[model samples]
Target: MPDLKDLNSIYLIVAFVVPGLIATFVRAQFINGRIDKMTDTVLGYLVITLIYYGFSIPVISWILTFEQGLLKTALWWGLTIVGPACFGLLLGVAAQHGWLRWMAKKLGLRVVHGTPSSWDWQFANCYAARFVMVTLTDGSSIAGIFGTASFASTDPTERDIYIQEVLDVDANGIWNYRSEPSGILILAKEIRAVEFMKEL
Candidate 1:
């Protein structure tokens, strides 16, 4: 037979830790930034878990206290997992859409941002129908259709790109698509800058 003390400890851990891990994982998908140290990460999760439990505990108290059998088990898992998931997703969406940033700005925290870099912010807003103009370090430039096939690296360290349907610029600086090359890959090292356009 399992020790009651051991079982209580397990229950306490499950009640706190699992939901936190799930919440953090879900939140990370929307908010990107520095990787915290392990201790900091653990403390962050614990805080998130506690805050979540404070609100959730009251709502699920009856089900937890009285429900039995498979229904109880299902509800318990849902409370522990799905509840936190929804909480995290709400947080993520808020953070991603700048609701958090807007609040921070109102609070005069001017530097608060959802993405780690301007590059990320720009690429995250990239639309399939837009145009991309990439200027090279060697005084040349590449124009392309930023269509469905194009890609920009999300990795902060890897600024490379695969732009589809390469274009040529006329003397008047208008962008027109080239027929031969279907796509092109430009390494981060070669790029000096990039610009986006709604129309070529």
Candidate 2:
């Protein structure tokens, strides 16, 4: 029930939307942030679409000022897609590595929608050297020193963590083990909190 213009607009929207989603995924994976939430994904796509236009418009106009004709039109359209995608990829990588995150925090851009932005990558990056206390939703807890290869997930409902040289804690909230248990795997969905251990 739509006309050619409507369909063309939909296609144009998809062109920006797909690349934006990919860029968001790339950055989220890099930072170990959950990307499966529908609201987060939809908001990311919309924001990226706006960013595409925000970046493309000025560059296209600047380029058009240098040339005029059908060739200029072709150049404008081509640059609109290619330039933004390349820039977005670089931006995403920077964000994943915590550089952009640090800058955002420094600029007071840390919280969004009443929630502080916390990435699992921050935990994964620092957990190797410290002891971790993983408390589960079922009231069971495990404490351990994680190996360097242990990892975290980007999915909130489905994350997995590995801990090596696990220490056993008694019923009274005291560690009772002088020996390590087997390596443990903790699922993020089952976990309630991860408490970092102070230096012993």
Candidate 3:
């Protein structure tokens, strides 16, 4: 059995948990609902924390070998935590930007453009500056040109978008914005579907 009263052992527990906590938070922010369950999140955090610390240990060890005072030691410890976090964040960004797709193409692999992996990228890339009809869950809809759309990387299900030149659909189902010609805000819970119109 291990000695529970040891101070170093407590620090070891903290060291083990900190990386996972930071990794999980970063990944949750970046990937959003990709991790649905608590168990999945915990498992993913453990795996990523392991991978990060595996690479970080040697570098941290080498840096700590340098002579340092109290302040410098604290700075090194800060670096140890921040370095892996920055790396994890960069990885998340690269993943979101379709880096994998780009790599596959470079390797002579064929993949479809406008893949659904990154919904925010897809919306901003494909739908921005284009006309669309946002159908609400209650059977009403507003058509307009997509001006600025905001995506929730923190909560993937939260669909919030902004529209310019807001149009009202007549009983004949035609859209006209001449009367209003203002902006409209749409929320996710109210939206049922989005119909793409002509590109501008």
Candidate 4:
């Protein structure tokens, strides 16, 4: 006893709502801790949905002229499910490659990279260490320790300071220190600042 108007409205609602919700949920689950991933996923879904409807609508209208209820509904649902999934996958791949990092830099965000440069053996009776922080032209920052500077072969004029350890600051302002292995140089760009520590 459902009227044609109500049935049509339901179909329209389902066509829009189902795909949006699924895309949002999939993006939230797969892309964690990265803002670019989330944004790309949403944008991709929007583009794909538009493209799908653009081509499908004319064909669907013709089909509706011949076929009625259940068959048309099935076709609509099938397209809804497939379109968002494909879009989300594409966005996820793009996000993993640092596209967001480049964009963020263009927006004048601060980027920091930290590494070790030299060591003061006199300061630390047990160990001598140097640190370097490379704050890029961007806003995002990366901190890492330079376990060995001799192998780094970096130019002295680069304003690089050797640090013993790299400190990673979370969004909450908590600091976690990670040490690098000897003879290995850690390179990060778009950093804020770098600091060095000496223990006697």
How far residue 171's Cα lies from its native spot in candidate 2, in Å, is 12
lDDT of candidate 4 over 107-163, digit per residue (tens): 987554111233221211223344334454565554545443322323333333344
Higher-scoring candidate on TM-score, 2 or 3: 3
| Candidate 3: stretches off by over 4 Å | 1-10, 33-40, 101-129, 138-140, 149-165, 168-179, 187-189, 197-200
Count the clashes in each prediction: 0, 0, 0, 29
lDDT score, candidate 3, position 173: 78
Clashes counted in candidate 1 amount to 0
- Expressed as tens digits, the lDDT of each residue in 110-176 for candidate 3 is 7775323555545635635777888899998788777554332334557676676677778897876
Per-residue lDDT of model 1, residues 1-200, tens digit only: 22447988778767777688788778767655334554567667778888898888676887867657998898888889999999888888886677877888898887646577888777665644678889999989988887777877866787898987888999999867666768899999999999887853
- Who wins the lDDT comparison? 1
Note the residue pairs that clash in candidate 2.
none
The best-first sequence of candidates by TM-score reads: 1, 3, 2, 4
Candidate 2: stretches off by over 4 Å: 1-7, 14-16, 33-46, 61-85, 90-128, 136-141, 167-182, 188-192, 198-200
In candidate 1, stretches whose alpha carbon ends up further than 4 angstroms from where it belongs are 1-13, 31-40, 105-111
Q: Which residues of candidate 4, in runs, are more than 4 Å off? A: 1-6, 33-48, 51-73, 98-200
- Model 2, span 125-175: residue lDDT tens: 563366788889999878977557556555565667787668877778786
Measured on C-alpha atoms, candidate 3 has an lDDT of: 0.65
To one decimal, what is the Cα RMSD in angstroms of model 3 from the true structure? 5.1
In order of lDDT, best first, we have 1, 3, 2, 4
